[model samples]
Target: MIFRQICSEKGGSLAYVLGDPVTREAVLIDVAENHLTAAEDFLRSRGLQLRLLLVTHWNASHEQAARALRERWGARLAAHESVHAPCVDMRTRDEDVLYFGEESLRIFHTPALTPCASIYAWNDRLFTGHTILVRGLHPKLHGQARVRLLARLCALLERFPEETLLYPGVENQGRRLSSIEEFRRRSQHGAGGDSADLLQRYRHLLPNKRAAKQREKARAEKNLHRYGPGQDVPASL
Candidate 1:
């Protein structure tokens, strides 16, 4: 597999280009407008055919690339069904596999960041998006929901190997990657964050059904109020 990690000019953002050596077929992950040219350049330089654009939840930044790549390279855009983007060619589900050449990446639904937020894993590398950051996990969810997110996230991480690599959607202190083992080790000591602190912080909190529903409603709005192909775009777009 061939891979390249592109960082934004101002720098917390990140994007990636991964290609299959055998087929020269590639997929771009979590791309943003700032790095689109750089990403496109790499594809051109390597003579790679962009097969798909897989988004693990980057806000509006993703829209630009989705349109550009689809129009220019004929690449399909895949994302969680709840992702509100007209350019999306595929509505992915949990455990769905996307193939490019001989390589594939599995989708893992993780909606705490946003209803569409997800993670993509291939071989031992995880394109974690905001689900699992390189610096740590700090999702802004309602109390009980936060608890559930932590639990589910832990359960999800456990499914992968300890040495599995994590490529975060956003960079932190110039640190854009970590392994499952490294995240856990840092958590134990408190230098880098882990679910432990989050668990402890919210352990005493009680569930607020009302607040949880309100949060869900807000996310629903994002999905409902977006544009779809050849349709009258929603006001939110």
Candidate 2:
């Protein structure tokens, strides 16, 4: 088996390509349009046929190129069912196993980033899309459901092997890869939580209810300025 990491410098998104040497069949995970040409050329040069194109999650930053790639390459396109788009040829579920010629990949559903967000693990490699970052976790972006997802991910990591290699989404000045053990430790030490709550608690170490109220108050004030007085913006809307 062979692995390739494709990094998008703009959003710090990472895509992957896994290939089987014997069958010369390859699978692409979360490729971006900007990197598509290069990825395809690299695979072709290796005499690998692009068989399966799987998406870990459907954030615009990661999936905008999926449609184009599928159309151009005629490969089977896969994604979480929540993507709810015709572009997806395979609707993936948690623990769904995919075979790329000889290798196997397991999908782990993690709603931390989105309802259908997930990570893909194969062998000792885990392609964690945007669930965790090296610099810090994004609580503000994750919200409430994300916290629950992170906790689950933390637990799942405990079962992973020590040799697991993590390719995180965040770009930092230092380390790039992480082990399951390392991530587990961080999650236990407050890396896993409601992103907004974590930020608020870290800022003042106050209770969630109080921090939430403060967040609402700040939002009200910000919106008041944007739309002027008496233009109450419903929080849900």
Candidate 3:
């Protein structure tokens, strides 16, 4: 397999390009609108035909790019069933296998950060979109709900080999990549302690519901301003 990771200039959103060297077929994951040209250029340079654009979650940025990419490359667009993107040609479910040439990615519905968030695993790498970050996990839920969510996430992660590489949707604090083992070591969610005690210890680290809403509102406003009312911003940004 051939692979490259592209970082968007605006929001440091990460996009992945993976190609099957034997078949010369490729796929893109978490493609950002701003990096569409670059992605196209990379495919052209490699002499690989794009087969699909797989989104990890629904967002303004990805929604806009997905349509343009599909039109340009005639590649199929796929996402979680809960995603309401018009460009999506395929609605994937947990354990669904997406194929491109000889390469295959297994989809895992790992929601909590967003209803449609998912993880794609190929070989030893996991492409986690907003579901898991190098700095911390998404803090959209709190209290007992948060604890249960964390436990669920931990369960899924623990199923993977410790050496598996994690490619997050966005870069945090200049770090864009981590290993499952490393994340498990640094995150409280990885601890064997009870969910209640773990939740208590990490409760302060997560934002309150009100603050999270305010942040979401602010982000929405910012997107509206940047892309104009109905326009789409780059997904990763």
Against the unseen true structure, what C-alpha lDDT does each candidate score?
0.81, 0.72, 0.82
Ten-residue region with minimum lDDT total, candidate 2: 199-208
Q: Model 3: per-residue lDDT, tens digit, 59-95?
A: 8888888888888888999999997666789999998
Task: Choose 1 or 3, whichever is better by TM-score.
Answer: 1
Measured by TM-score, the strongest candidate is 1
Output the TM-score of candidate 3.
Answer: 0.78
What ranges in model 1 sit over 4 Å off?
139-142, 188-237
Model 2 C-alpha lDDT per residue in residues 1-237, reported as the tens digit of each score: 788877766655667889999898899887877668778888988888888887766766446677777677778888887878777789988888989888889998887556877888888888776776653455455444545555566557756886688877555564567777676566546554434455444433223456778999999999978876454656554
Residues 27-99, candidate 1, lDDT per residue (tens digit)? 9998888888899999999999999998888478789868888899999999889876678889999989989
Stretches off by above 4 angstroms in model 2 are: 141-146, 191-237
lDDT of 2 at 109: 86
Candidate 1 residue 176 C-alpha distance from true site, Å: 1.5
